[model samples]
Target: MEREIFPWIGASRGTSILISKKKSFHYTDVIANNSSRYIIVSGIPQHRKITLINIYAPNSGQLVGDPILLGGDMNLVNNPLLDRSSRPLPADAALSTALDELQRLLRVTDVW
Candidate 1:
């Protein structure tokens, strides 16, 4: 995952790229894609650290200003009518409402 990642980015003739905690972003989720899977996150070096969130899981309310490619599995059911579940739970209007509110807050729309 590290080979030829940033062919366009490089240090100046006399400048060197400094790698450190402040120059990168890190995140992890256990229930999204696996029981436990570690993911390496990073941002543009020399810039402020960026925070990334797993929107589908909603671990944090902080939304990325850029378009977020949210993809995950948290076993959450916002719409029983459209979303599938192994054991269907009673549909709650409040849950649906909350989901709508979340989508609006994030300015994100479902693909389907």
Candidate 2:
């Protein structure tokens, strides 16, 4: 099944998750906004819960679980010096700081 969340005004900006029916996982909760979507699912066999988050920008939120994975096009970079070829923008620096704090709070590792 294809799950999509579009902005209230239109579908110009949105995120989608395609789940196969044959998969042994089903979604239990979903939280979405104009720029982000969060889905919690449980594996049928192991009954392990997982939270998946997709984001388009910097948005603060929380999820509780042993393992959580996030995929996004956030404009923020972890290390500007290594990630960027030019000088870091002010806006990006702020967002990067916010992202760092969020990651620390969530105790999640950046796989970038």
Candidate 3:
């Protein structure tokens, strides 16, 4: 029997990033916390490098440099009236502030 291996990062419990065996790149750096996982890959066909982040935020974390893609459960809603149910819960003000700061610093836009 043979076993197939895939490149991955992060703890078993929290946030994680898994690279498919076919498209997995040569990663040079990794930063993982309770709420996020950062992986820096090299020799990305055309681009020199790209950073991939899997984040679950409002908790504290370190920021990564540019040419990156970030996605995860933000634990936030843009318009509670439209996005939430009948009993809408308010997002934590402090967390919202922090997330906003992160977005500004990263200069990235939400895709959806």
Best of the candidates, lDDT = 2
TM-score against truth, every candidate = 0.33, 0.38, 0.32
Candidate 3 collision pairs: none
State the lDDT of candidate 2 residue by residue for 1-112, as single tens digits. 6433223333454455555555665566666654444333332324777766554432344444435566656667888778899998777777788989988997878787
Off-target runs (Cα >4 Å) in candidate 2 are 1-67
lDDT against the true structure, each candidate = 0.44, 0.59, 0.53
Clash pairs for candidate 2: none
Per model, state how many residue pairs clash.
0, 0, 0
lDDT computed for candidate 2 = 0.59
Q: Residue 26 deviation, candidate 3, in Å?
A: 30
TM-score of 3: 0.32
Ranking according to TM-score, highest score first: 2, 1, 3
| Candidate 1 lDDT tens digits, 37-71 | 22223443345554332222223446556455766
- Which candidate gets the maximum TM-score versus the true structure? 2
On a 0 to 1 TM-score scale, where does candidate 2 land against the true structure? 0.38
Worst-scoring 10-residue span by lDDT in model 2 = 36-45
